[model samples]
Target: MDFIARATAIVGGTMVLLRRMSAPAAQAVGLTPTIPEAKKQGIMTLKMPTAKGWEPGHKPTAAQGLKVNAFASGLAHPRWIEVLPNGDVLVAEALQTERPPTSLMDRVMQATMKRAKAIGVSANRISLWRDPDGDGVAEVRKVFLEGQNQPFGMALVGDTFYVGNTDGIVAFPYEKGATKLTGPGRKLVDFKPGGHWTRSLIVSPDGTKIYAGVGSLSNIGDSGMEAEEGRAAIWELDLATEKARIFASGLRNAVGTAWEPVTGQLWTVVNERDGLGDETPPDYLTSVQDGGFYGWPYCYWGKTVDDRVEQDAELVARAITPDYALGGHTASLGLCWMPEGTLPGFGDGMVIGQHGSWNRSTLSGYKLIFVPFVDGRPSGAPRDILWGFLSEDEKVSYGRPVGVTIGPDGKSLLMADDVGDVIWRVTGA
Candidate 1:
């Protein structure tokens, strides 16, 4: 980082929030889920206020021939988001994973307004939002998939919308142009949603196979050192055959996966393990090779082994890690590769949602970043393309971005903020 950039960050860091409010809901869903009964207090819904010395928001305006607008607002923890054929969106809220409900004592707290209502988790479902008027806003949003575990990733294949639940995969006969879902489909696969279980999925461009990423069940393989039944791997399911097998392995957790239109190279953003004391292994965005390994608990960031887990530093020195380290704990997820060709406006660009940071002392990365790529490869380091969701000093300003997509209208961009349960669009005005 240059001096000016570094200095800007120092200014920005001051505003980062040091206190904890409502935890980044998506991160909680992806990592730890404590039983509500075990906790003495209710889940926090407070938005941590920004720090007094935080940097100012450097949010960008849509380039010429481009416009950005807020499509909808008032959402609750919008997690994995997918665009539908008829200009609608399918989203899952990781509410079901909100620790098992508490007991009578917890109920007392609820009655006293100390906790949220309902002991049972309603998070196990997906919701649909539609912008029928096409006025650059979602006028309606309703539940589409229900009774789920931790419904996260979603993909549309013809009439079937594949929903990735914490425990498995299910297909629903999703209807377009409708604000509600009332039908059920079939289950494609049953999975073990554990340690690292935020499933991100995509269908092959040709539409024959489905690729779903399942994160590690252990912090690194060491937690489950012995059990390897589908831990830390991306599995490919033959859409025509319904058979699933490991597609790639050793990725601690690859949250976002997309195919570069110009080159068809696979790209991903992975969440490397934590507890390496804040600076060890860096999370990354890289082109994933089929049958290749981006070492997890064993290595990271161009083959740097984590000394905490791997005893032999020599082995860590040899492993191949990710191509681009997206800094530590930025929590990059839901990737979208830009336009078809090498246009000046976008140099084979990619957009990643940096879902903010926890586990670290000060807050960082709760916005969108642009990773410019060319000729099917990264041309340079990522720059904060879309920022300001988190306050200048560390408090959340507007909302946390979970997913990014081209609007159903095909001209603008849509970003989902999980906390607000809202969808905002950036389009040509």
Candidate 2:
């Protein structure tokens, strides 16, 4: 509230003063500011905590190292990932797009998180990685798709690898050792296009249905879908028939969604509606149920209202809100849960790629986090899995992490960075 009130006041005051003050009068006011040269701040420097997987969680003083690998390079704004059975990796690359602009959501995120940014992140198409002959590092680079508006999140159901593009879903056949899309790619489904265009994909447990997450192109409820013109919602499609319909709605930006293996619960990571000034509503992780309506463009986290959203008395009762709240504006993305018997120390852990923030005073989220789950349920709060993408000197960072997927090896973790144009592979120490 303090931040919002302050910013709002500044906004109004600035506009009024700009209208009244002439350029000459303002110049005579002695506002001769110029970009200045730098000076070292002495021993005073930003101290970034070491990452969890890259370093120890707790110690007498600081943290310790686990192990890390910058597995491959030469990627161009790589986004989401899908690990092939044979250990190859498919990453989406973002070539020409810039990050999205910060909206009201960034204001709240900046207020809530320690180091939130005031803008949106961007990404692009898929890049392929293969380590044939059992090499530890990736040895192959290939394009899975070209000329995508922007692509992210992908899943493999049997032989087909499905990719989420800005306005549609496409799939190509996969052979264990194949390095490229085997056949001409086929369009699986399409959605109404708007600004929030990074569609994410996942297959149902049975593989008969394809579950796709479509974000609201805009934070408001009025963003009309392109050809399909509609509000925000998750939709399900019959794979064979190419038929689709709404699965859930009122979710502002459900960027990352996954299905829990043990309980068949559908878990989603959300970038909730922003702009109430920091603590009003948080981005969330939840087991989104069918037909559920987590309020968007009006209410958040079960009725904490934002001025941007029109008030409705029944909004709280009608919406199926988030289960657990992450701090506001972390810019949460790419969600995957470790199934039982995989990643031993994790038992069952949820992985989210926090793209980081620029809308706040301080920055937050430049790495991956682990949410512990028990018997198909979240047991406690999120834990940092891998950290330290931003350097200690970076009070603000240029790198933003976008998506994460478990490495196909079953013992490693994979992450995508839109800013860095590379994939980071973390293995247990």
lDDT (Cα) of model 1:
0.63
State every prediction's TM-score relative to the real structure: 0.76, 0.76
Error of 1 at 407 (Å): 1.1
Candidate 2 deviant stretches above 4 angstroms: 1-65, 95-124, 133-135, 173-176, 222-231, 312-315, 340-344, 391-394
Per-residue lDDT tens digits for candidate 1, residues 1-429, read 134334433433442333233223222211111111111112211223222212333233444444555666545566777887766777777742334334642333233221111122446667777887778777787877777777788888877778787677888776656565567668899788755668878889999888888887766665455664686778898989899988877788788888887788778888876554333455777777777766766766655555556454554555555667665567787688766332225555788887766534445567677777777777665655456666555533455567777667666667766654566676544
The number of residue pairs in model 2 that clash at the backbone is 25
What stretches of model 1 exceed 4 Å from their correct place?
Answer: 1-68, 100-122, 175-179, 310-318, 340-344, 395-398
* Candidate 1 lDDT trough over 10 residues, lowest sum: 30-39
